[model samples]
Target chain A: MEKILPIGEYIEKGINSLEQNLSFLWSAIDDGISWLVENMNDLFLAIPFVIILALIAFIAYYVKAGNKMFTLSGLKKAYGLTIFVILGLLLIYAMGYWEEAIQTTTLVIVSTIIALILGIPFGIWSAKSNTADTVIRPILDFMQTMPAFVYLIPAIFFFSVGNTPGVIATVIFSLPPSVRLTNLGIRNVPGDVIEAGRAFGANENQILYKIQLPLAMPTILAGINQVILLALSMVVIASMVGAKGLGSIVYQGIQQNDIAKGFESGLGIVVLAMILDRITQSIGSKK
Target chain B: MADDNNIRIKVEDLTLIFGKRKKEALELLNQGYSKTDILKKTKCTVGVNKASFEIKKGEIFVIMGLSGSGKSTLIRCLNRLNDPTDGRVYFKEHDITRDSNKQLLDTRRTEMSMVFQKFGLLPHRTILENAAFGLEIRGEPKEQRDEKGMKALKTVGLEGYEDQYPAELSGGMQQRVGLARALANDTDVLLMDEAFSALDPLIKSDMQDELLQIQNKLHKTIVFITHDLDEAMKVGDRIAIMKDGVVEQIGTAEEILTDPATEYVEAFVEKVDRKTIITAETLMFDNPIIVRFKKDGPKAAIRKMREAGVNVLPVEDNDEKFLGYVWLEDMLKLEKEKAKTVESALNTEVPSVYKHYTVEEMLPLITGHHHPLAVVDDEGKLEGIITQTSLIIESTRFDDKEMDKLIGEANEL
Candidate 1:
C-alpha cells in the first residue's frame, strides 16, 4: 500500500507539471497573438518610414550613376537624401505624440545598443574559442526560437514591468541575430587576407582593425540592420509592459475602434522603417 | 653592421606542417601512399619542406614554382606569416622565428613590407588612406602620413587618384595602389607573392618594369614569388626553382641557362630560347689584333697585322674602327692581281645591339652566319668573336641523349 501510494503521488506530480506547462504555453500564445493584433497599427506607421528611406537611397544611387561619378550622385544622392528627410519627418511627427513615441524609441534604442554591445563581443569570443562557440550556440538558438511574449513574462518577473523590463524583453528578442552575424562575419574573413596583414607586420589589434573588421564590415552591418528591424518590431509588443509611443497610439486605436488613427500611426511606422533600412543599405554598399 | 650592401635574409631548412598530425601524414607518405591516401590516413598537409635560400641586400631574388610547389608558403614563412614548423630564418643575423610578437610587429612595420597576390586593399578606404594605413597604425601624424601617402601614390603613377576607392579603380590600378601602400611604409625588404600574375600581360609587363625601376632606385632587398619563368628571368638577380616543396636549382640566370645542375633544372630551361639569354660577354674571345689604318691600304695593314701576331686587324680610319680582315690574304691577292676589297675578304660582321641581348638572339646568327660573328661595342669597334663552337659546347652539355649514353655505358660496366 505504501509503495502504491508513492507511485500515485509520482503520477500526480507528473500530471501537475504537465498542466502547468500547458497553461504557461497557452498563455504565451494568447499574449503573443493579442500583442501582435494590438501593434498592427504601429507596424503600419513604421512602413512609410521604411519606404521613404529606401526611396531616398535609390534616388541617391540614381543621381550618382547618372553623373558618371564613381561615388554617390544622381539617384544615389537623391535616394540617400530622401531617406534622411523621411526619417526627419518621422521624428517630427513623433514629436506631436512626443512623450509616447520617445518612450518607445528609447526602449528600442537602448535595447538595441545593449544587444549590440553584448552580442558582438560574445560573437567574437565564440568565433575565437571553439568551446565558447559550442556552449553559447545552443543558448542563442533558444533565445531566438522562443515566443516573444514568453520572454516578457520571465523578464517581468526578473526586472518587473515598465521601461527596463520592456528593454530587457526587446534585447532578448533582438540579440541573437547580432551574435550570429558577428561570428559569421569574423570567421568568414579570408585566411589569406589575415596572413597578408600579418606578413605586413600587423599585430593582433592591427589584424583585427585593419584586416578582419574591414573585410567583415558588410556582414556585421547586415547583422546590425537585422537587429534594428527586429528591435522596431518588438517596440509595440513591449508597450504591453507600460512602454509607450506609436505602439500605445496603435493599442488605443484598436481598443477604441479608431481605424483612421491606426492607419496614420501605421504609415508613420513604415516611414521610419524605410529610412532605417535605406541608411543601413547605403552604409553597407559604401563599405 | 648596418651597411646597405649585406646579406639581408638567410633561411635554412625551413619546413611548415599544417594540422596536429603532420608526422603521421609524413609517415604515410613515406610508406608509398598517395596524397589522398595520406590525407585520409592522417589529415595533415605539408606546405614547405626544408627550403633554404638567401636574399642579398638590394638584390631581387625570385622564387618560382607551379602551384603547390611551396613558393607562396615559403614567402609567407619568411615574415612568419605562416610559422615554420622547423628551420630558422634570420634577418641580418637576428633569428626572426624567436622574436616576440611585439618584436615581430616592429620588424614588419618598419623593416619589411609585403604585397599580396590579391592586392588586399582595404575596400572602405580611399587610395590615399589605404596607402597611409601603416603610418596611421604606427601613430604617425595625419599631415606627415598624407604627404608620404601622396608621394607613394605619385611613385605608383596614381597621383591624381588618391581620393578614389579601390572599387573605383581597375584591377591593375588597384594593384598599383597596393604597391603604393607597401612603398609608403619605406620598408627595407619587400616580399611580393605573384604581384603581377593577376594583371593582363601588357599590364604585367608594365608592372614588372615599374618594379625594376623601383628596385633600382630604392635598392630594396626583394623576394618575389612567381610561376612565370620569363618574369623570373627578367626581374630576378637570381632564381630558385622549386618542385614538390624542394628547390630544384638556385643560381643566376646565366648559370641556370648555361649549366642546369639537375635533370629537372634542364627540363625547365629546355623550351626557353637560348640566344636571347647569352650576352656578348659570354661569347667573346679573349685576345684579338688591334690595328690602326692611316688610309685604306693593303700593304700597311699587312705590316701592322704581322706585328700584332694575328690574321685579322681592325681598320681605324680616324677615330672610327671599321671591319677587320686578313691583311696577308688581301695583300697577297692584290700582289697577285686577284684582290677583292677588304669588305669582300672579311669573313663576318657583327652589329652592335644592347649589351643585354640573351643567348637566344645570338644562337641563330651563330648558326646561319657560317663564320664566327664579331662582337662589337656600341662604338662599332670589334669586341671579339661569338663562334658556333662555343654555342654548341654550352648547349649540348645538357642533351638527354649524352646523359643516357653515358649512363648506358656505365651500366654495362
Candidate 2:
C-alpha cells in the first residue's frame, strides 16, 4: 500500500500536542466527574438494603401514576412493570452482585442526568432557530454514529482511565437521543396552540414555559428512557478503562475464562437493565 | 354611522398582504390589478385591501363574505394577530398599527381579547386554567383569576365544566369555553374571527342566541366575522360586506339588502335567504285598524269592515287587548241569526306570532290556515296583522325594478 494518506499519524500528533497544552482543562473536567461518580456510589452504598428496595418500590408507585400498591386490588392495577422492578431488585441481591449493580446504576444515572442537562437546552435552541438547528444537527449525527470504542479512546486520553472517563464516554454515546427527541417534540406541537398562546398576549418565554414545555414533556421523558438504556450499553465498553461496576465482573470473567462467573454477572446486568428500562418507560407513558 | 366618541375601533385604509415583498403587492393593488392577478404576479396574497370601517361601541359589527374573501384575515388584523402591510387601525384613536410590542401586548391583554374559529383553548390546561389564561398572563393572583374564570364560565353556561379539559367537551362547548376565555379578561372589545363557523347549525344557532343574550346584558363592543350571510344578518347591528379583500359596503342589514352600494354587494345579498332577514316586525303594520268587540254589533262590525274596504276586522277588547277577528260574512250570518253583538262570530283561534319572528318561521304557521297571522307584543296586545296581501308585497320588495314594472303592468290591467 502506498503511504499516500498519513491522516492517522497527523491526528495522533495533533492529539499529543492538545493533551500537553490543554492539561488544565482535562484535569478540571476529570476532577468534577470523578467527584460526582464517587459521592453518588458512596451514597447508594450507605443506604440500607431494605430502605433502598422500599424506595425503588415507592418510585415505581409514583411513576405508575398513583397506583395504590398497598391494597390487593391496587396490586393488580400496579401493573407488571412495577412487579418486575421489585423482583429484579431482589434477584440482583440474591446473586450477591448488589454492590456491583448499584455501582452500575449510579454510573447510568449520573451520565443520563448530565446528558439531559446539556441536551434539552440545545434541543430547545435547535427547535427555535434555523441557524442553531443547521449547526447542531451534523454534530449530533457525528456523536451518535461514531463507534462507542472510539469515544473511550479520547475519553481515557482526557480523563486518564477512571470512572470519570467512563462517565464521559457513556455521556457522549448517549446524548443524541435526548437532543433529537426534545427537538422533535417541540417542533411537533400544533401551530394553532402556539398562535393561541401568542394571541392571548403570552410573551415568547411564557409560551415556551406554559404551553410548549408541558406539551412536550412526555416525549422528553421518552428521550430520557433512551439515554439511560444507551448509557447502560456503553458502560460495559467503558469497563475497559478501569471503571468499576458490573461491567468489570463480566470483563474479569471473560479474561479468566470462567463461564460461571460471566453468566452470573451478565444475568445480574440484565435484571438491573430491565428494572430501570421499565420504570423510565412507565413514567413517560403516564398520562 | 356612530358618533366619533362612540366609535370603539376605526380602521383607515388598512391593508394586509400575506406573503413577503409587500411593496410589490401594494403596487400591483394600486394599479387596480385583481387579487388573483397580484397573487400570480408577485406570489403574494392581498388579504385585505384598504379596508376602512368603524365599529360602534357596544355594537355587534359583523364583517361577512364567502370563504377566501379575507373576512378571517381582516378580523385577525384588528388584534394584530396578523399585522397589516399598510395603513392604520385605531382602537379608540390610539393608532394600534404604530404600537410597540409592549404597547400592543398591553392593548391585547387589557382592552381587546379574541375568540378563534378553532376554539383555541390550550389542550393541556383545565377549562378553568384556559379561561383564566389572559388573566394569568396579566399577572393576577391565581385565586383572583380563578374567580373571574368561574364567573366567565357561568356567563357562558359552562359553570360545572371548570375541572375538565377542553378535549373532553363537544365542539360547541369548547367554543363556549373559548368565549369564556375571552370574556374573563373583561375587555372593552372582543374580536370574534368566525367564532361559530366550526360548529354545526343547531349548535351555531344556539351559540348565536347565547351571544345575543350575553350582549344584551354586557353590551361589549363585538367585531364578528362570518362566511355565512345568515349569521351576519342575525347578529349584526351593522355589517361591512367584503369581496376580494375590499370592503364593498358598510351599512345596516336593511341598507345592505335594499340598497347595496356595489354590484358585487347586490349579487352577494341577492343570494341571502330573504325570509331570515325580513322579520315579522318589518312586515307588520303597526296599530292596524280594529273593530271593538264590546261596542260593535253585527251591523257596526259590517259597517267598519266596509269603511276599511276589507272583509275582515280584528276585534279588540276595551283594554286594547286583541280578542279575535270577525268577517263581514260572519257578521251578516250573525244578523241572520238575529244576534245583537258580534261576540258570537268572533273567532279567537287564529295563529299569532311574536313581532320579531322571521317569515321562514311563519311559513309553517301560515300553512293550511286561511286567515292572516297576527303580530303581537309580549302582552298579547295586537301590534299588527300580517295578512296574505302584506306578505306578498313584502316578499317582492327586494328587486325594486322588477317590482315596479310588475306594479306598472298591474295598474295598466
Candidate 3:
C-alpha cells in the first residue's frame, strides 16, 4: 500500500524481458508439448469403444486380482469392479458425451504422465539431497497454495490458449502432490532397511530401484491417485482457455444458462472421476 | 580350536565419527581426546573408536557390549554399512575399507553377507523372495538363486513358508527368513548385527542353537554382534568386549569371564553366573598321580597311592586306557588276598566326565568324591581330575581387590 518497492511492476518488467530473451527456448518447449498432446489425444480417440471398455475391464480385473484370494467373495469384488467400469462407460455413452469423455480422459492422462515424469525424479532428488529438498519444498508450497485461476494467465502467455496450454497449466497445478508424496515415501523408508540393502552389496542404483522404490511404491501410487484427481478437477478451468472436451460443454452450459447441458457433462466428469479414483485407490491399498 | 594362521577377517584401528565435522573429531580423537570430550568440542558422535580385532576362519567372533558401546556400529563398519572415518578392514587379504564401488560390490556379492537385528526383510516380498534378495542383487539367475534360497529356508527350518509375505509370518519366522537370505548368499563371511536380539528369549536361544548347528555344517566365518552377554558367551568362540567406543578386551569366553581386562568388562562379567563360564577343563587338575597298569599290581598300587598322599589313584593301562580308580584300602585288601593285577583291585565305579562338560554339570560328582572326578577324553583315557577344592577355586577365582572395589561401587550405587 505504501508503494515501497512496486513489486508488481518490477515482476512485469522482468517477465517481459525474460519472454523476449528466451523466446527460442519457449518455442521449442511449446512445439514438443504440442506434438506430445496431439499424438496422445489421437491415440486415446483412435481406440474403438469396445476395445476401450474391454481394456478398462482388463485393467480393473487384473488390479482386483491382487486384492483377493481364490474365494468366491474375492472373485465377487473383482467382478463387481469390472461391472462398475462397464456401467460407467455406458452411462457416458448414453448421455451422448462419450467422445468428449475420451478427450477429457486423454487430457487428464497426458498431463498426469508429463507431471509424473518431471515430479518423480525431482522427488527422488529431494529425498536424496538436503540442498535439493530445501530448494524444492518452498517451490512446491508456492505451487500448491497459489490460486488455480492464476495459472491460466501464465499458460496463455507461454503457449497461447489451447489444449496444450491448458494441459501445461494442469500439470503445474497437479505436480506438487506427486513430488511431495513421493519424497515423503522415500524419506520414510526405514534407515536400517536401506543399510541392510547396502550391507548386502547392492549398488546405489540397485538400492534405489530394487529396495527403495518397491518399498516406496504404495505411497507413490497414492500420490498418483492425487495427481489424477487434481488433473480432473482442472478440466473445466482448462476449458476456459479453449481446450475442447466435456469441460467445454460445461463451459458452454455456464455461459448460455443451459442447466441440463451443465448437469449432463458434470455427471460425465463425475463418472470418470469415480472410475479413475477406484482403480488408483485400489492399487495403493492392495499393498 | 581357532587357528591363528587361518584368519578370515582382520580389522585394524577402525573408527567412525558421526556428524558434519567428523574430520575434526577424528583428528581430536587421534590426539588423545576422549569420545565425550571430542563430542563436546566438535559436536560429533563417535560411533566406533580405534577398535581392532581379527576373526579366524570358520569361527564365531562376537562383538559384545552394553547399549551405546558401539558394538553395532563396529559390525556395520565391517561391511561398510556405517562407513568408518578411519582405518582399514581386511577380508582375507583385500582391504575392504578402501575398495572402489565395483570392488566393494564384488566383495559384498561373493565374499560376505549380513543379517540385521530387526530382520530387515522387505515387507512386500514373500519369504522366498526375501531369502533370494542378496543373490538377486548380485544378478544371479532366478532359478539358481531360488533353489539356493529354498535350501537356506530349509536349513533355518522355514521350508514351507516360502510364499508368505514377511509381515504374515511371526517375528521369529521372519528372522529365519533374514538368516536364510544371508545363508543363501553362500559367502564365506557373515556379518550379523544383533541378529537374534529382537526375538523372544526362548526363540532367541533356539535360533542361537540353530545358528551353531548351521555353522557346524557350513563352517562360515561369522561375526556376530549382541549386547546380551549370555548370547555372546553361548555362541562366540572369541569375543571382543566394547565400552564407550573402545574395545576393552578380546578373548575366549573363559578368559573374559575369568580375567576381564578392564573394570567395564569386569562389571559385565560380574553379572555372568560363573558355572556357565567355568568348564570342566578349567576346574580339572592335569596329570594327577596314577599307577601303571600291567607293570604295577595291587601291591604297587597301594605304594603309589601312599606315596602320592592320596586315598585313591586313577589307574591307566600301557596305552593310556582309563582302568578306573584303585583305592588304597581296596589295594591293600586285594594285596593281602594275593590279587595279581591292578585291574582286580580297581574299583571301576569312579564317575567320569568329558573335558567339555561345564563345572555346573560336575557339581554333584565332585561334592562327595573320595578322589577328584576323573576328566576323560572321548576315548575314555583319563585327561585330568576335577577335585572339589579345584572346582571351588576355579569358580571363585575373582581377585579379592576387584571384589572389594566392586563392593565399594555397589554400596555407592
TM-scores of the candidates in the order shown: 0.75, 0.84, 0.88
Per-residue alpha-carbon lDDT of candidate 2 for residues B1-413, written as tens digits (9 for 90 to 100) = 34799998999999999887789989989889998899899999998999998888999999999888889888888888899999899999799999999998899889998898988788889999999999999899999999999999999999899999988999999999999999999999998989999999999999999999999999999999998888999899999999988899998887788688999999888878777777787778777779887787888888778888989888899988888788888899988898878887888888889977877788777667667888888888999998865565566554567766776898899
Candidate 1 lDDT, A1-287, residue by residue in tens: 44645875685677567556676764564455335434643554556555644555455455334444455444455555555655556564654653455445555666778799999999888877899999999999988888888767655654446555576778888999888998899899877667756766677777877778777878988898888888888877787776667776777788889997777666656656665666566566653
Candidate 3 residue runs with Cα over 4 Å from true position: A21-58, A65-71, A79-87, B1-5, B291-311, B316-322, B326-346, B364-369, B378-381, B392-413
Task: Score candidate 3 by DockQ.
Answer: 0.75
Model 3 lDDT per residue over B1-413, tens place: 34645998888999999999999998999999988899899999998899888899999999998899999889878878778999999988889999988898888888999998888888878899999999999999999999999999999999889999988998889899989999999999999989999999999999999999999999999999999999999999999999899999999999998788988899888878778778888767798888888888887877777787878888888889887887788888888899888676666777899988887787777655566688899888889987665665556665557666766897899
RMSD of 1: 9.2
lDDT of 1 by residue, B174-240 (tens): 9998888889999988999999999999999999999999887889899999998888988999999
Candidate 2, residues A196-272: lDDT per residue as tens digits?
A: 77778889899889988889999999999999999998867878898898999999999999998899889988887
DockQ, all models: 0.47, 0.51, 0.75
Rank by lDDT, highest first: 2, 3, 1
Give me the displacement of residue A149 in model 3, in angstroms: 2.8
Give the whole-model CA lDDT for all candidates, comma-separated. Answer: 0.74, 0.88, 0.87
lDDT of 2 at B117: 91
Reference contacts reproduced by model 2: 0.57
Model 2 TM-score? 0.84
Using DockQ as the measure, what is the rank order of every candidate, best first? 3, 2, 1
> Cα lDDT for residue B394, model 2?
62
